[model samples]
Target chain A: MTSSLVLGLELAYWQQSILRSLGILLAVLLPAGTFVYLFLFKMVSFMQSRLGPMEAGPFGSMQLLAEVGKWIQKEDIIPEKADRLLFKIAPYLVVSTVLLTYIVVPFGPDMIFANHDTGIFFALAVSSISTLGVLAAGWASANKFSLMGGLRAAGQLIAYELPLILAVVGVVIQAGTMNMSGIVAAQANGEIFGFDGIGSPYFITQFLGFVIFMIAVQAELAQTPFDMPIAESELVTGYLTEYSGIRFLLFFIGEFAAVGAFGAIAATLFMGGWAVPAAWADLNNNIFNLLGPLILMAKMTLVGGFIFFIRFTMPRFREDQLQKLAWTVLIPLSLVNILATTILKVAF
Target chain B: MSEFLRDYLTVAIFAAVAIGLLLVVLALGKLIRPVRPQADKYLTYESGVDAVGTAWDQTPVRYYVFALLFVLFDVEAVFIFPWAIQLETYGWFGAIEMSVFIVILALGLLYAWRKKVLQWL
Candidate 1:
């Protein structure tokens, strides 16, 4: 069935797979986005040593619900001077751009949608377009802060985008494939110091590269130590200063969605998304293939927790510092990482 | 998809569904919620004061310079991509191409640094 379908481009299977992938993606996205938002919302309040939404529904989890309810019913305000078309279009654009990146992410064993040969690149390219949505949102608001924020986003995204790609290149070199599952598979089959496959993890194989990747990802997500564009005190919530109510909700969803997307991607590439750790190789027999996939999710959730931990702990960087890191440190490091990767390919 | 085609299809389908679902949720929210737009509420105001002054705000030229320098480097950085991609097969040739590319990239950085642009930020 698989071979013959392949020969004929089986439209039914293609259609079915597409539908199934969509269902799976929605399934992952809803839960992932909700998880990140709820986790952060709680963490933020918890750090202040105050009780968060602990009454709404069994633990104040329904706080997001009440808040979302209030936002939805709130008056939709449009500034008379605002560019109306762009104003209406901006939020949806930003929101769409942010969540559209989940197509290539592998959630469990062979569970990715549209597993492109260029899965890594596909994710990168799609996510890159989100900056445009951000930029548009800023420009359309017809406010100076919004414009500045938009410009900042454009600069920041364009600036750090290279280092991000370069670090991913190192992973590609080590894994010997660009497809994400392939990267995870490489981790699964990686040499463990020749003791019948007992080599160190990819992090050990390419320590510098891993650091570069992590920092670049931090920059890409505009997280702590790189979050200049949205520095609330400086630009007044950056591009979102003028947005209110449901529109504000859209922007909010977009931001948290990115956290989930990046978390999933990082898990797939570096932390071995759904792939099991080395000690569990004996469990790779036919009967345990199912368990192998669960191991991958466990790893993903672990990484997601760490990301939330960092968010709660770190402080934002100044715009100058953000640019400096991108241009001076990240760009140079990216170039050198590429150089090392090429040398490793040739010499090793 | 023989193992190969399934992979590509997976991505395409997933992308469509995530985006579709997000829109659905958002649109559903709008449909269910009652929107009330008041004439006075829509008035342009800063800090709750009305008709204080024109909305055109001032910004430093330095940020523009930062963006300009950023664009130049970003475009140049893309050059390394093709070479890095073929590194496994091109080996020494790819390495040499990359070195030359890096040299030019380094010079661009040098130009930015000498002009004290990075210092400005």
Candidate 2:
């Protein structure tokens, strides 16, 4: 049974894939947005022993929905002196790059939109384009605070991008394919710790890569210790200072979507994607393709929860210290991990 | 269309959809949201002080140096990716080649470090 095209255009084989891709994009955004809002606010608030946004929905669950309404109705402010064109386009550029990342995300077994051979590579490269949007937003704002924010973003993302890609290389080496599904398949092949009955995830063998990736992702998301770019206390909401209302809302959505996207990538890379645990090893049967996305979402929640937990708990790093952590620390560590991984791959 | 073309087409379509969504939201918000402009609000915010000359001041050159350094290492890191995916087939031969490449890059980083080029002013 195939989905009917509403546009009245005759469908071809490849068009079906595009249709399915658009369907997944439409379906995933609501849940992804909800998951980001609730998980971040609740987890951060719970850490601080405070109730967050409880008045809006049950335990403030409906708060983000209400926020969307309020933001849509609020005034859209473009500063008078700002570069009007870049100011307007920057947020869309960011949100679009992030939204595009969902295209390659493997939702389930054979459940991906586009199963490119360069899947992981494609996702990383496209997401980096959001940094340009960030710089544009900063430069066009005509605010010194925004300029600093943009520069910090450029410096931080550029420094962390190396380690992030390098860390993934360890997993890519082990998995033998850049395809997201192939990485999951590699993880599902056998048990880790031999007797533990859990699938041997790359997280176990590539522990250093996992650590570096997590740190780099934290920086990539610009949260907490790595959130120097948009630190409210210092930069007055940083690059976002001049933005208000709907344009600001675009950046907000883009940031959360990026967190969700990166979390999905990390889940796919190190946590065995959609692989059901050993107890459900038999359930890994290809027929239960629907279970893949559910399993993947569960893993994402755990990883994302941990990331938000650390975000809430950690203090902001000094600017130089943040760069130092990426270069002097994560880069060298990821390199060592790659060397070790190569040796193991050769010997075994 | 060929599958390769379709794959990239999906990316283009996704981008179009996102931009379209942003435009829709902004247009909708413009219909609903209140627009109140005042002369005071238009001035650049300098801790609420009156009338700053201009915000487009010269930023320190330190950020430029880091960007240059980033380009150097980031380009070097890109080579590791293709080598990584093919590591098993080429075995020790590929491994040794990668090590020399990495060692050279490491020396560059070390050289920059000793030169204090990496140090934040």
Candidate 2 TM-score over all chains jointly: 0.93
Q: Candidate 1 lDDT, tens digit per residue, B1-121?
A: 3767666555556556555666676677677776676787666544555654444566554657666766676566465544555577876876787778777877888788788878744
Model 1 lDDT, full chain set: 0.70
Q: Candidate 2 lDDT, tens digit per residue, A1-348? A: 233555787676445655665576676676567666667777777778887778886778778889889899986677788999999989988988988887888877667877888899999999999999999999899988888898899888888998998899899888888988788877877555454466768788788899899999999889888998898889887888888888898899898888878888999999888775545566446855788888887888788778888888889999999877877888878878888888888877
RMSD of each: 3.9, 2.6
Q: What's the DockQ for every one of the candidates? A: 0.45, 0.62
TM-score of 1: 0.86
- Which stretches of candidate 1 lie above 4 Å from their native place? A1-18, A192-200, A277-279, A282-293, B1-19, B51-79
| Candidate 2: regions farther than 4 A off | A1-21, A190-196, A277-287
The most accurate candidate by lDDT is 2
- Candidate 2, residues B11-84, lDDT tens digits: the string is 77666666776788889988999878877777666567663656578778465776787888778767877888
Can you give the TM-score per candidate against the true fold?
0.86, 0.93
**Model 1 chain A weakest lDDT span, ten residues long:** A1-10
